[model samples]
Target: MKTLLESMAHGCARCMYCDDSRGTDIDHFQPLKLAPLRAFTWDNHLLACSFCNSNLKRDQYPVDAAGDCLLVDPTVDDPADHLYLLLRCGEYDSYSKKGEHTIRVFGLNRPDLVRGRRDAFCLACSKPRDWHNLRQAGDAEAGRLAQALFDSPFVDVVHAMHRLDPRRAEFVVGTHTLPALEHWQSVYGG
Candidate 1:
């Protein structure tokens, strides 16, 4: 079960919630105590880090006024629909109740995670230009660089950048890097 959950995780099997640490815990998205009937259910399992599963979320499950789960299930939902990353600060802003709840439960804005996102964003912004340079020079290493960029930690940052409007993306990554980013997005499908 743990193996299966890990296989479902994104970017080198990172934690589904934080997308930072390795997913070492087989977390029950719906805690066994709250949903005992789902104990053996595959869809109820998720890959999580120790910090997210044990320290933060634990067995708590918050629901909205409508009784719908407030947590964002990465496997079943598009997190971008609820949460948006602020490129300047590496913090996430919530546009939905579920996003807000999930941020609180997962500590998405924790200092370490914020720093990681910021660092990853900077690196992501730079890598496209590097790839472009390598490709322009006809270097064989371009593919490897592209793969590493895609597999980097905090990959959600890159995805968010891709989802940005052209003007905003150009502003965030700068005009020089924007074209390279767009080229990579076109080739990689973001």
Candidate 2:
């Protein structure tokens, strides 16, 4: 139990499904009802929000027509391959079928989640520019901002916006000079 809690602490505490809410439940990535044999397996366990776990997801584990999982596994697949956030509208746009299915099943684009994500994005985008204006600030203040940015919810939204930067020469996040996003990589990484 201590080990499990430690892993959650060292990583993003946000729900894996919505990435907006607190991870209040340790969910079976493959539901126990559907795959009982794997109930106690660590790889099968994922931290999730109560809303995504008890409300939206319930026991549903969507599969493709051929019976393969349609949901993006945060531990395996890159979520960017499946889903990208529409920062302007605060909705997730699908780049793959898995993304569409995951969104439908977990209600990732629900109004409440969208609002939260939008707020996260706006602040993540604007705060860096603000910091740029206050260029004379010391490392101590910058450190505080970095801590706050990582502590903020729905940080993936910031990553999504960074991915779409006009000056993004590489497809990776290495170049986007958004303040405090470096803190995000240090914590819960993509």
Candidate 3:
């Protein structure tokens, strides 16, 4: 078994295997059943969650012409750039083909994940002005944001929203999602 977790940490964005339970496995990115030629090729390997590798994806490698992927590669591209977490409905919407494909392929809007992302979004939006102030203060905003994100119960929401809707970025920080804001304010020091 290759050290797929290490490879993913270096390359895959938010590589799911980074939070492995039983260590990582060498997942064939394209699926060995679909692209047997690459069954053992290093380039075809990736570190994936058992959920992503087994129950959800399996050997299903859907692609478009030029053999490009229709799904998100947490390795090659940022999932946040294309996918968004819906605050009210907890569904995912996409602004681009890549995002659409990823959402469909990975079931990014699955009810459990949707709920989780919405909670994460709530945490992100609860303290919007602080983020703005941090930005104005020139205080390594990226690091602050990253820390705030993990600390927030709604951090997953921020990541999911960033993935689905970079174009209408305000949804993550808008007032329409006030329930999340209230929750954060009451519990998370917002």
Candidate 4:
């Protein structure tokens, strides 16, 4: 299994699936049953989440007329290039057929999930004092903020972002966690 740091750093950024929390199950981007030749290729391998790996995306490899996979592999390409996050509606808009399929398949705009993300973004923005003080505290202050987020119930949002968008999550967590990293035991895995 890929380490948390590795998953967060590479997997999340790449939007590749990684069932690190579960077992080390290597999945083909396109199912081996469907595309036997590409099955063993390194480009076809993706680390998947348990929900995506087992329940939803199991053996469901859709291909194009040329027999190429239709699914958007975040590792190879940027979903944002085709998909746009509708912050107001919490849905996704896409210009490509593959992007549309991916959003629908993954429920990228699930209402509750979208609302949760919006709320988290607002929360991070609302605390001006925390942010202002963070700059003055430097490393010591960053540790404190990290600790505060770790202990807070609101941290679930932070954790989810860590999995979904590591770069954004890391930025949020790093910026917010200033002055206190110890309090954020909820993240940083202690």
Q: Would you estimate the TM-scores of all the predictions?
A: 0.95, 0.80, 0.60, 0.57
Candidate 4 residue lDDT tens string, 10-106: 3222224321133245567677777799864766666555566666677876667997656778667766566655433444578687777776665
Cα shift from native, residue 111, model 3 (Å): 0.5
| Residue-level lDDT tens digits of model 2 in 38-149 | 8877778888888899988888888977999999988789999999888766889899999998889999889998898878866876665544444445445655665666
Model 1, residue 46: distance off in Å is 0.5
Clashes of each: 0, 0, 12, 25
Angstrom error of the Cα, residue 75, model 4: value is 2.0
Candidate of highest lDDT = 1
Candidate rank order under lDDT? 1, 2, 3, 4
Alpha-carbon lDDT, every model = 0.88, 0.72, 0.58, 0.52
Predicted candidate 1 versus true structure: per-residue lDDT over 1-190, tens digit per residue: 8877766666699998999999999899999999899988888888889999999999989987887899998778999989999986999989999899999999999999999999998898899899988988999999999888768889888888878787677778888888898888787775
Please give the TM-score that candidate 3 achieves against the real structure. Answer: 0.60
Better of 3 and 4 by TM-score: 3
Misplaced by over 4 Å in model 1 are none
Q: What TM value does model 2 have?
A: 0.80
The C-alpha local distance difference test score for the whole of candidate 3 amounts to 0.58
Best by TM-score: 1
Q: RMSDs, each prediction?
A: 1.3, 4.7, 7.1, 8.5
